[model samples]
Target: MKVFTTTLGEIGNQLSLRLDSKYRETWDNEKGDPIKKTSLNKIKVADLINRLPIKRVKKGELEDECNLLSISETEAKYGRLVNSIQPVTSVGSDKTILNEAEIIVSKLVMSKGYIFTNEESSTDLIGSTELIPYKKRKKDIDLTFIRHLLLLDDYLKYYSGLETGKTPSQKRVNPIDFLQLLVPNVPYDIQKEIGTKIRKLENEMDELKKEIQNRNKIINEILATEFNIDFQEVLDIKKPTTYKKDLLSINNSFDLRFSYKFNAQKYKKLLSKIAQHKVSPLKDFINEPIRLGSSISPSDYDDDNGEAIYISMSSIKNWTLDKDGSRRVSEEYFEKNKVANSIKKGDIIIARSGEGTIGKVALIEDDIDAIFADFTMRVRISNSHNPKYFYYYFCSDLFQLIVEKEKKGLGNNTNFFPNQLKRFPIIQVSLNQQNEIVKKIEEKLEKVRQAEMALVSKKLEIDNLIRKAIV
Candidate 1:
């Protein structure tokens, strides 16, 4: 009997597992002609399958299909499923749901591709695209084999269209269209073997995530236990004495408390002393205050290699410094602008504007001549300022709570002017007390960081082994 395989373009082009679209070749960092590729596919969803047996199963049932039954239902479900990991509570009525074993189809739309699913498994109000059944098809290829084949670049390219100017529009993949594509004939036993290997790798990734979370918890506990700080104190900048209810400044610090282990005793103590600071809008007491990007002359800046370290928006994440990928500028640019006065290693860099991350802070550890970008604000504490203490304080749950409360706008982004950032409130502590807190935090954080690195290395090893086994 002749075997049948589905191509990605045959499916409707919205979002799904069958939608595999190959990305066009692009220039690499070395300017070499090396081709870059991804394993993702664009699936085209269609109005078909509304009558299919798209039953909503519990997470346990789905896990059983993937494990004991050795079945695959890898479709992205809109509403909550039995084993939904990243549960989306706010799914639209039209959204689709697929058994964890079903495959999502894809059709390349632009430089990147979108996912597709079917209505039978999805909510009618949410309007999900479509779901293609790999397990149901009685072909030489097993479900796992189908999943692996869909991950190939050849299928994506076959379904993807030509580049129009700089943008490319990929053809969508419909269910009927996908079932007609040519697929490799692989043995069922081989597919099962590969699936086992892939699952093992995925487990490693999960372990790494858990390890990182726990590590961060340790850091939080140390802060709570040693510093006597509550993770949720609201720093009241304007007293009732200063302004009426309408004008009073009340900011709930960041919700970092969620990331930390809660300590009721420490929280109570911190709350009791909230009004101790007599000053309005407390200062962190820095020796040198640095304004980002102001030190560089506009004429001297270059995108290429310069002597100076440039801290771009991408260089910072979770208020921690990403030293390897941060931007760099020319050293000569620093001298010409006379911008080096206040820039220092210990300065806390804060985001001035952007979505959701406005007022995020990072401590500079690089000693090189570095300049901040326009979107960043830099501050250095004076002799009175303790760098380590300030680092912990900025990263504290209470501080982040205050920041979100003061958040002005909406959407994925946010912004705060330099003056507004300066006026942003902080919890005031004595210099000696601040140093003590920072010391404890560093010791605990160091242990956490070490554990996280080990877990990451193990995950990388597991992924490499699985990929090698498949290839």
Candidate 2:
């Protein structure tokens, strides 16, 4: 008699059935708004989560601010990606202790940032917050697979479901609850295969993204070279010999950054770029006067049937507004405050303050019954400036760098004052050149956008296949 062995394909088919059932359960288990009506998702996340004690280093032990993780950094990647960070709070009621279990969760979030670690090491995690250092082979689990799982839509929805709190700042997720979520259980060898496959797909996607970014860099490089702008020199760190004396003056004047030389030089360099061309104070180029957003509380309004849309600062991202994330105000409130908080077409919007969101600029392209919150600012950019061109530059790194330095405060309290926004500069070129630049940039951007859409479709297909593969 001949014996037969089960194939990976057979395992995957079974997994697909299991995932379909899981999706049905989740759809039926709807708690609040579904965002989209489409049915969702696969794989049991609980089986894959390696429940281990978290560790964190103290704020005092680390000299650099970037070493400490902030809550604002937690919004994306299951609170994993640590793009940048501020040092621990020097003076605040909420303090973080270093090298402990509370900090351990932070490590779990960013463990993948470290790619090359010795698997033989006894410590599953390293002391430094830069890497995820966990080692447990006796149980034979895969962290890479788990990391990607945390990034999945099914997992994110479940995680969001676990969160409690009426508003964003007040909201929090329980680590214990997160650990309890179910995950697909597969053979150890198969787990590694799924992880490796997903990593490769991500790498391919990343490479294509790099190409798109390089194309954008080409646009900025063209702008700089054509205008002979040397940003490095303009932003040089070399200060005067009497820096200490000037530093006192800067502090006394209430500038948190104390970058007197940089700001002064930046103006000189900007003027140099303009040459003899007429420059406009951001105020001059505004037809409708610039004003800060209203202090209306979002908690006051109902979600669906409000008279007007209440725009939250969170809805403004990378020069675009997410209407779904916005809140709706009651009819009475809208009627009373609509004139004061009106956002007309062609008006520019910016996130004025708060952690993770300062100086995020977007343009209102539609006329709608919407009212921006207190943490936002609005201005109708004049006909003199091209809204697209101005918005593109506002979203650029060069502009963000300025905003980053100018912003004040720590943690969730971080703020960009209204006075600073009022004083912002608006550089102008001929309307024809603005049109040409916009035309050139959009042409390349459209290609990148199409490629990105295809990439997303490909990713979803691969993710579904992976769910099926190991199940």
Candidate 3:
């Protein structure tokens, strides 16, 4: 749908015979004459830095104890240094040696870039081959400034378009192409000033994150008191010695479970405490049978102007549904699967699979034209119970602890079936009491939400400041 034209002379100057539409489109959109015409001077990245050669060292050759820097240990954007220490045998692959004067830029993703700041250490650091190291040749250039400049959207887009690989995940930027990118040639003083301002803003963001963590602890404390169970204590309890007789003693019927995690001593103690209160299985309050979503093949996905949203496990986060990054399916698929997968107000959805994502619960407050994926299950509460009260309970540690005990499988493919969820214990309370509890929790959650919004606004301010400075 997009079109552009370039002269043959321009192609010759580029030193590459790339005539692909995607590359040309990105070049026309981001590589305008502004970099050359602006009042501030512009310089190619090659003019300010020298590329360091990759020196691969086998695990046997490394010192018994040394610092190893991997790309996964470093964060995108604000992270500036790598500080991982481990035995030589722990290193997975060959590494490239780096000095304090060099900056390592991740070729896999544009946002990941770091500068070496620890000159106090006498030994040279080794890093993953995925990171391309460059040493500054110009004394006046600020490495921090250059790191942030590479993260700029304009440069990233142009560079990404030139990346080569068969698949999106495997694509990488070549060192030659990276060195050819342009950067703003601001004064050395201004560059340092921008870096300092960014560091200050980053520190403020860290404090706000700590505040959010404290607020979560407060919420958990309130839930602990209400449930009359020390969730952390239950988690910390070690696995007790068990025998085949112990499993038979609990349940002799054909439905009896055999997994050790299912009959852990900690879970048994927690259940005994709940028995003292008015409690019942979750199946008792369900208005209808629990619904498991059907699978949709990726071939059926229609990301461009699709009619219905495909709600996967990623769509549910922080006790709510997030539309961002969710896939889209054709209207035909929705109509065919709506009976079991359609989401309605007052219904609750839970992630039924995935390692870290399992047991995530969200309450649907409004009707949505979306269908849940196979990895998620939905529950509709009866009119006799307050749905919001159960929503809060599902979001609490008590329910999550049970999930940890019940979920089956290994690693990332864990599963919590509808039968296990139906047998979940729920504390039964009067309608009036349930409403009161919901109201109390909502009040506390509102304050947390406000703090979260402020953090988001602060992040935007920092991003805008960087954009303005570079422009």
Candidate 4:
């Protein structure tokens, strides 16, 4: 006789069961057990809930309540099944409306025991969240222990195996079968110990988050102080529009986004606000006109490990080139696609196009052969401006705001024209002044970055220890 095990954990139960191909391929929903019935206690979801076979809220009620929990209370939130958390909607949610009794009236549609409120809201969970209510929370049987047990990497892997559907989002869990599965009968003292340890780790992580926020606040304050501008005034800058109706300016050209007759005066008036200021168009310091790169054929691409390199939009990251993700192209292919437009030392490139990528600025660092991607704008600095100083300013939030305004479309193809970026406003400081500002900001920010790195490392170690401890 021969035996077969479907999953890694199935080997433990191989002696008890023999699964045919049909049973294994179909996920054995009819008979496949994610976890073998152990010597521990078990209870089905039906056993824990007063209401079995829970139903989704009525259509009318669902629509209204879902709005309250929606991303914006109006816009729908789209998330894949893997990212979806069991929401614990209760009191203290954003824009939370309270009932006359001081109890929270959360508007949400919980389908099944899952899809309930998340960690964001902490007040007493109401509505249809399948959890035992606060008043019903048992001290001898701590539910937090159950959370830890369920979240164990081994358990989740099996839980994921239990999911059945053609697609990831379409996957569904069997409540009856899942709830019937057993976990170790942890003693009350042991349960409290595990709960306390995990909670302490979480609290430390929260402190790390606060440190990051405080550092960012200090950086923003220093920037404001250096510019001799009121922090509130800088924050008050009007948000740019999506160029509704395409305002052609007095120049009578569509090239100018502000050319529309109705809004032309308004646009000019905005630009004029800086006329008395030292700010100038960024083009003033540019040695050459902003240039866009050529699109190379896919066939022209070589392996990333190859001799020649061809940079793409993904290569621009965090104020520097992402060499690992960059592509490679042969010398001949590069020549065919116009080698003159390739990247150069001191060249600044901004991601001019793509979803979530537009407005990303990066500086080329001595990689003359690395060609720029087609969806980017490139420039070589003039002798008048310090490349390092100018590059930092371009990567700053101020420049990002201006570039964001010039974004031309919606969705993945959204982009800002290079020409618009050329005309972006800049505070025309002397070369020495720009250098000093960069030095000042980076020096302070470096300490913040180092501190953040240490905190992140500690978090990873703590999380790993917790996962192993429970497992």
TM-score of 4: 0.63
Determine the backbone clash count of candidate 4.
13
Q: Worst ten-residue run, lDDT, model 4?
A: 98-107
State TM-scores per candidate. 0.59, 0.61, 0.77, 0.63
Ranked candidates (TM-score, high to low): 3, 4, 2, 1
Q: lDDT scores for all predictions?
A: 0.46, 0.56, 0.71, 0.53
Ranking by lDDT: 3, 2, 4, 1
lDDT of 2 by residue, 1-471 (tens): 333344445335332222233332442354222322223333333344333444544434333432343443433442222222344424232233332221123323222221222212222122333333233334566555555545556555654444554564444444444444444445668668876776667667666655555443555664565456665553452334332335564566545554543345454454465454445556666776678887776466877677578777887865588777777888888877788887878777888888678888777888888888888888777787787777776665445555655676667776776667555555667888878877877787777787778677757866675556544
lDDT of 4 by residue, 1-471 (tens): 444347756534433332444334434442333335344454433233222222233222222332223222221111111123234323232232211111111112111113221223332212322221211123364444444444444455545555555565455444533554445554567666765665566566456555554433454565567765454544444544444443233247545444222242334443444354688787888988888877788777778545557667788766578877778887777776555677678888888887678887787777567677778888788977878677776765556555555676656877877668778887788888878877886777677787688766755554454354434
| Clash totals for all candidate models | 83, 24, 0, 13
lDDT for predicted candidate 2 compared with the true structure: 0.56
lDDT, candidate 1, at 179 = 45
* Candidate 3 TM-score versus the reference: 0.77
Off by more than 4 A, model 4: 1-121, 124-191, 214-221, 230-276, 307-310, 317-321, 325-338, 365-369, 409-414
